[model samples]
Target: MADATTIVPLNPDEEKFLRALGTVMALLPRVVDADMLEELPISSTEYTVLVHLSEVPHHQMRMSELANVCGLSLSGMTRVVNRLESQSLVTRQKCPEDGRAWLALLTNPGWKMLEQAWPTNLASVRRHIFSRLEGCDVAAAAEVLQRIAAP
Candidate 1:
């Protein structure tokens, strides 16, 4: 292993790429969240939770697992689920397989909410992300991102 105090300088291109990546990481979520809030009843994070639940079998997932997938702390996920539950969009139940754990279940109302919000989410994504990539190879970009994000 290299010495902890050793310094390796970044090339100009590498430095530029890192700067742009940091800015995008900071900006993208705020922009998307703003768009979602402007046109829909839900924020982007809430919409994400709904989308994940909708895609899963039985429209249910463990609360901890949901937190992981959503990139939220367990408490944060609980709070989001609480808001959804209050709106009658989702429900929390004891995990059948693990009594100590909780599960998040999408409700019929949640499906309706997702269906209603789909267009706005799609438009927001296209407008804020894909449109900016006009002539870029989107597939390659996605593959690179997936690799970067892999555990």
Candidate 2:
């Protein structure tokens, strides 16, 4: 690791921006989690997994792929998938082409759950995020944030 003494502190504008970004990063999840817990049966993480699976061709994806898409560790994804499987929201099956790999497939109930949750999720996003910004603000923020978040 580099020596702490060599590091330069952020300038005031950079500090302000980072603080605001950190606040939003922390608070936005809580806001979304509260809405989800109140209006739906799933948490935000589960919703993310489901949404990604829903976007795929067959409502199914490899466990590792799902983990990557959801930004979860392999073990973390396994735990989440186990919970979802217990709830009958998803099913885990051995991959046909690869005997050692597993696939997570969304169930009918999962689809229904997602459908029911969509309106609540959308409203919460609007209430917490989009409502606070104008169109141009949203576009600019999206561009900037995406750039910052990109690998």
Could you give candidate 2's per-residue lDDT for residues 1-151 as a string of tens digits? 8799999999999999999999998999899989999977788889888899899999999999999989889999999999889889999999999999999999999999889888888899999988888555777788998899789
Compared with the true structure, all predictions reach lDDT values of: 0.94, 0.91
lDDT, model 2, position 17:
95
Taking the tens digit of each residue's C-alpha lDDT, what string does model 1 give over 1-151?
8886796889999999999999999998899899888987788899999999999999999999999999999999999999899899999999888999999999999999999989988999999898999999999999998998899
Candidate whose TM-score is highest: 1
Candidate 2 Cα lDDT to native: 0.91
List residue ranges in candidate 1 displaced over 4 A: none
lDDT of 1: 0.94
CA displacement after TM-score superposition, residue 95 of candidate 2 (Å): 1.6
- How far is 123's C-alpha from truth in model 2 (Å)? 0.8
